[model samples]
Target: MPASVVASAGSSPAARVTIVLPTFNERQNIQPILQQLLALRDRFQLELIVVDDDSADGTADFVKQMAHGEPCLRLIRRVGRSGLSSAIKEGLLDSTGDLAVVMDCDGQHEPAAVAAALDLLIARNADLVIGSRFHPDASIKGLSDKREGGSVLANRLARFTLPRYRQLSDFMSGFFALRLDRCLPMIRQVDSQGFKFLYELLSISRGNLMIEEIPLTFQPRTYGSSKLDISVLWDFGVSIIHTLLLRMVPRRAVSFALVGLSGIGVQLLISNLLILLGFSFVASLPPAVIASACSNYLVNNTLTFRHLRLKGLQLLAGLVKFLVVASLPMLANIGLASVFYARVANDTLFAQIAGIAVVFVWNYAASSRFVWNTP
Candidate 1:
């Protein structure tokens, strides 16, 4: 709202654009991207918000130092926080611009494309304008064959969740521009934990927004290494599932349920192996149950409740707490199944399934609150 920030080169009224750059540890790449973006100030009123997740390499501090002289430049140093989508969310929400552009700070996303994307957003009166790497006219020399293939597969899966915007070539693209006022409602519903904020926005909008795509020329990063890892893939898969489930189920619940299914597999495998080894059914059951519970606890700690993941002494203490909280449910499972099997029906499978369902609900609820301290 400063007079200087609103001033544009031309007489035509300029839309104040907030260019949000989400960074982790891009100290090597930040300066160049910032300079390129700032160069566009003559054409458009621009506000550059660098959302840094407390990078160990002091990416935030560098941005802070740079912001001292530049009135349009600002830095949001997020301590004890991470994730690209969340950072983008925070940046967009904090923006005072009429339009917002979210892009990578690592230099893979072309800074020049910001102007084109914003222009298209205004020209087409679109709520969202995506800078798509997979657009037919778009050039992608940045991603390797493997990464491209993975992106292709992810976009395909993402399309299934987005029936209306299925034609979008790059749902996984990081660079995008949006009319902030139009997207504000849907943006609030977007899951910050998602790996792709565009996908989250598209899915949450439920085809209400007028969307368009602009060709993006993605180049390889010059300084920093790629953030692509197994954990990112895992988060992407979770995001897809979160969309497919109609956002009715909490993402953590889905992960918890999957972990529970794995626990069931462990229990069955162990129990069957024990039976083959001449152990009695009753004798094998306890060890198998205990083994499955331990497996579930460990996996839930690692993936289901990863944000509040236990470590070292905390791990041992959490395991103890998990077992204690799980005991009542474990007992109820056995008790309910026995009652149903003995009194109501002789169907062992039906009784066991009913018990498993109870155990899953109880364990997930109890473990979330007690074991992980998550609500």
Candidate 2:
């Protein structure tokens, strides 16, 4: 631990501190991190909760085995569900402590920072204390240059969503502490499906909370591979959009709209290509429409409604149901576009665009309720 990661001596030793570690296939990393956190029990009343996302690697089982001997250690095994933000939310909600700390089990988030964060939460009388990698005194020797650059860009974007905490250096940091009493109401209302739980908390607080930051020494992961990928970035982008929209629109709906826009592009591209190949505009439209609907269903399964993602036989079933649910809207899109092309605009692009717009809401609502069985 660096000198900058000093634990505050000002906090009360009797204060119950709950540390929430969200894990996914992090079997190798859990034990070491738990041991380090348990070491803090001598100074603070510590309760360690490992929220495991049904890791096939038996992460939950490992925690359960350890909990058998250690009263402070507990495990939450979530089946048929996955997502870092939700896991953290569930852990925090289940916490039986006055103060709560949320961090990663990947070993990248330094366990030593928890005490320092807790101290800041008490000493400064702040509602939330974030462990920021971008803090002036912070160090992130473990982060790659590319990852660091991406994080910097993400923090900049996050500031816009959190107008009250615009001075925050790391809106994306997984390590943070908060006074649970002040945050519980907001936590309950947080969009658990969002990519970043901290961002959701900060955004929901609307700067009304007295938020502060502590320097964090982000370490390299020693066990599992990094989960940062294109999908995570896509979710991050959607989160930003959700905040920007004043959160009036559902997060899933925002994702659906974005995916629908991509589908529109696919439809227009294929429709124009077929027309150029000597197919009549009307004849070219149905194939293009069907193709775009298929693209939307696949993308939606992977991104928009990932929590209810279908696989193997279920995936085939979902695609069939998606098409069936979409059939009426598909007909509406084609008929409206064809009418516009023949009578109103006499322009294929304009007609198709108008047609797609007409059924956008119906497709989202119907598919979500019927195919995905989600409201």
Candidate 3:
């Protein structure tokens, strides 16, 4: 077994520490990482749990075999549901420990850093301790400039949503430790449907918790491809919108606004595409607006108002209602935007930007109250 040490702590020897590693198709990396974590049992009363989302690559089987030999290692094979946040939540709820640590199974997160995070949690008495890659002493290796740039942009954008977490240089880091009891309450309050849970946790804590950051080098992945994709980025964007508007507006309303934003993007893209295909700009507007509304209704039904979601034939009915709810706003968006463009000196961009803002507020209010207003 590789050398693994527990950070100095004041807790009794009997006090337990659980490390929850969420995995999917991590067959190549699971065994060695488990060996490293299991070694920590010598210093701290430790329990290692692998919460897997039914990886097709034999991740669960590998974990089961390891569990038979090591009494401290446990595996929870999730069958139906998937996602890292939910996997962590399952492990956390089932954890029997004073402190719980969450880390990636991709091997980018150094196994040795776990002890350092625990050290900060013990020494600083922080509610949460993050393993940051952007810290002064941090070094990120093997990531392309584009990927690193995305991380930098995401970290900055997340800060805008929750200023309390602004102190964190790496909010996107999946490695962190917290008191399981303190985290449970906040976890319950957050919608952990998305990729990043730390943002939700800090947003729930509302900038009031005792948080600390520890510098660590982000090592290059030794195996498997990166899971960071456009969908993950979209999830992060939704999380940011949810965090920002959650403080003042109703959840459904915020979701409605977000869905509308995506619809607007779809509309612009389709309209431009039609224009490129030789259709007159004016003739393309109606089809673009209609297409966007239909997509928005489907997205809103499934994601925004998911609790009151419609299906099959009800979708056809919801589409009609969505068009009705969106009709006036569509006309108003165009008229108002055109008026702004005509009045404003040389800024056609400002006109559409301001117009969309106005129409968005109206659509959220009208749609939430009338179209899908299920309590």
lDDT by residue (tens digit), candidate 2, 1-375? 222223454444556789999999999999989999999887788899999989999899999999999999989999998899999999999999888899999988888888788877877878899999999999898799999999999999998777778888999989899888889999999888898999988888887899899998889888879988767888899999999988999899999999999999999999999999999999999999999999999999999988889999999999999999889989999999999988999888889989999988888899999899989
Residue pair clashes in candidate 3: none
Instruction: Give the winner by lDDT.
Output: 2
Instruction: Write model 1 residue lDDT over 3-54, tens digit each, in one string.
Output: 5333442435477889999999999999988999998787777899999989
Which 10 consecutive residues of model 1 have the lowest summed lDDT? 2-11
TM-score of 2: 0.96
Model 3: per-residue lDDT, tens digit, 288-333?
7788878888887777665466778877877777789889988876
Off by over 4 Å in 1: 1-13, 336-354
What's the TM-score of each model vs. the native?
A: 0.91, 0.96, 0.74
Highest TM-score among the candidates is held by which one? 2
Query: What's the CA RMSD for each of the models?
Result: 2.9, 3.7, 6.4
